[model samples]
Target: MARPRKPLLSRARIVAAAAALVDAEGLEAVSTRRLAAGLGVSGPSLYNHFRTKDEILEAVADAVSAQVDLSMFDESDARDWRTALHDWALSYRAALTDHPNIVPVLARGPGRRPAGLRVADAVFGAMVRAGWPPAQATYIGALMRYFITGSALGSFARGFVDDETAYDPADYPHLGQAHLLAERREKVDEGAFETGLRALLDGLALQYAAVVPDAHAAAGTER
Candidate 1:
């Protein structure tokens, strides 16, 4: 007896389902079997679309990367380097934070993923367009990514901590004070994000400017 061919499941749908699973029930809940169950198919069916779980993650990351508005940073913009860098960084951070379940994964081995490379390309594009040298642009991209991920992780931790811990102001003054700040003006809020992002961008711009004097000079000359 000939078996009927299984209907095609779109790659976009699979990745979107995986992303939804991660959002609903953390990354640990995502597996080939589980996703298949969610998708009304058998485990083997997923392998037809995604070679491995990592591939699925890569696809999901690519979907997330697509959320960034690359057009916002014009290659021909007359804005200064810091302004351009600020625009790029803010957009990148916003996209990452919107996918909180996946933000931590960004710090991990998306190194081999093309979607991850898209992010790097955007950062490099912004810097290069602003007359930054290749080396400095690379440094700025790495620095900004690291800092943004680190800050996001810290802010994200507060939510998990609140759910798990019985925090008291009396025992830990500084932590309590910080918690109070978060409570009154949340870490994940726009103000906190703007402040953290601005501070990091400021430091990065300063360092890149100092070490890449020739590049800075060229930027000024171009203007």
Candidate 2:
């Protein structure tokens, strides 16, 4: 088959197609030959832009980062880092929900992706400016990553199929409502995330208070 139009074979187009494949299938499906076949371009053409499949995967990971919202810091009151972190964590999970296959690769850290680095810089910068110690601010970023990536990897809400007769009330008396609860797992997941986010921020505030008591003093007015 003839090569695809040269314009269609640019780095962005290639990365987009590769990412789409991973989004549809799993990450294992993104080999160079497969990616090129999907794009209607010769495999060699892909080499002109990327040296290897890992390079393409890196770009794909960065593409996923591009969709995350950083507006928590951009538009919110800068002093309200607790609220900002909560919003940012929500946005992080939302973005990963759309491109979940990329989560493993993204969990590997920013590597050399410019967009990924910018995300780290933005979050860390926001927390530090809000009076968190430098080491604590970095830990906070890592702490969010630990939970966010783990959340992306699996769904707590994805319980067994709902069946009224699955749980015998005689054997497990307290689990009688399990059937009904499982059906509303989406709400359960959202509520759990919100509850955990509030608690995490509340705990972090104590650390911030110890180091920056005055900052908390002023922020208490907003509470």
Q: Write the per-residue lDDT of candidate 1 for residues 1-223, one digit (tens) a residue.
A: 9765865677877898999988778788889888888878888988888899978877887777777766646666676667666676677777777787777677773576776787778778877876677888888778777876776565643553432135555775556434344454354565677787777666666666676676664343221
Q: After superposition, how far is residue 20 of candidate 1 from its true place, in Å?
A: 0.3
**Cα lDDT for residue 114, candidate 2:** 90
The lDDT of each candidate is 0.70, 0.83
TM per candidate: 0.77, 0.88
Q: Relative to the unseen true structure, what is the Cα RMSD of model 2?
A: 3.0
- lDDT assessment of candidate 2: 0.83
Clashes of 1: 0
Which number leads on lDDT? Answer: 2
Q: What is the C-alpha RMSD of each candidate to the true structure, in Å?
A: 4.7, 3.0
| Predicted candidate 2 versus true structure: per-residue lDDT over 171-207, tens digit per residue | 9899877787667877887788878877887777777
Off by over 4 Å in 1: 1-7, 156-182, 185-189, 208-223
Q: Which ten residues in a row have the lowest lDDT in candidate 1?
A: 156-165
